[model samples]
Target: MPRISRSEAEQNQADRAGPEFLEALARGLRVIQSFDRDRRQLSLSDVAKQVDLPRASVRRTLHTLVQLGFAETDGKLFRLTPRVLTLAGAYLLSNPIASILQPAIDRLSAEINASCSTAVLDGDDVVMIVHASPSRILPLSAQVGFRIPAFASSLGRVLLADLDDAGLDAFLARIQPHKLTEQTIVDKKQLWQAILKARADGYSLADQEVEVGFRSISVALKRLDGRTIAALNIGIHTERGTPEMMRQTFLPKLRSLASELQQQLI
Candidate 1:
């Protein structure tokens, strides 16, 4: 018999897993998530490095993704195909929230001449569920379905602020935050304070923590029932304004857009 691979051994052990736990399915999704805005294409080794799986396991996953029409490869490198959008499209089409906000989001981004987006907190990350950018795309431009760390932006802070004390504490305990930029907040105490301040002020502003020369301000989007369901934010280049200028000039515009959405999102 040939030597079985490390991931193969792991998969074989899935037979012992709980009835509801689908180990193979979980690993498949992790392999898919390893491709993102920063990593559009990857080799077998690159994927193994990302998902921390054996190359043999990564190879199997990649070929499976290819057969499913979710990904494609040119012998050496693999990239997700447009067919992958079908997965995201299903959510966008089914979720009334995404559809309700997209047109307004586009208008807001155009009005601000910047990128505007909405996000919801999921685990340790904030997923950008809807987005629009009127200006040229930058290295940091986010689109629909972008998942960024919850601690990295104003948009995330608003969502985090909506959490109760127990929920916030639970999030803090599990997250292993790292610096995304020089200004990124890696300290737990500071992150806690930022979230508290967002709760008190009804908004949060982050300056260049997610990317250099970028700033964002966010306000929570409350439904008619007064639940803070998501957050709305606008991305601006630092040259566009100082922090104070962002407050004086752009914050109200962002808030106004949120207010209009609140009326219909009920």
Candidate 2:
């Protein structure tokens, strides 16, 4: 019989104990995530270090991924294959929400000549699901599938504001806010107050919180039932306007777009 790898052994134990989890699958997914823009190509040792998995487990996971055509190896270096995009493609194809929002975001970006994105809260971060940018006057941190800390993002605050008290408390308990910039509100009490303000105002803004000289304003995207499912935001260079100027010029448009998006869900 072939030798069972550590991941396989763990999976066997998990299966025997219960059916709620699959350790093998989890490890394989972690291997996939180990490759990103900054670490696009990695050797076996690099992947092992990044995922904190034993060399044997990482090798097995990489082999499985290569066999599935989701990754490729050039003898020594391993990189994700274009086939991996199928995963994102499948998600976009199956989800009408992404399709519905893309056109609107495109139009908005063109009209304002700025970047627009829609994100959903995931764990302690906000994951950008759709992004549209007309120009690159300033660098932006958001892109499709990109994740940013929720504690310091306008999109994050707008989505966080939708949580009920118990849910909000649970989130606050779990997330350790870190200061990303001079303007980042890392204090728990101060962050909670910001969320409360967003909840009352139905929108949120961040100035140099995620990055210096970048500003954003976000409004919640809701369902017909009035539950916020995601957030939509416009990203602008700080040189374009001050915070108050941004609100005065763009808030109405953002609110109108949010309402239009909500109506589409109905």
The candidate maximizing lDDT is 2
Off by over 4 Å in 2: 1-20, 136-138
42-107: candidate 1 lDDT, tens digit per residue: 999999999887778778889999999999999999999999889889988999999999999888
lDDT of 2 by residue, 35-87 (tens): 98789999999999997788888898999999999999998999999998899
lDDT, candidate 2, equals 0.89
Q: Please, what's the RMSD in Å of model 2?
A: 3.1
Output the lDDT of residue 93, model 1: 94
How high is each candidate's TM-score? 0.87, 0.89
- Candidate 1 scores a C-alpha RMSD against the true structure in Å of 3.4
Q: Write down the lDDT of every candidate, Cα atoms only.
A: 0.86, 0.89
TM-score of 2: 0.89
The number of the candidate with the highest TM-score is 2
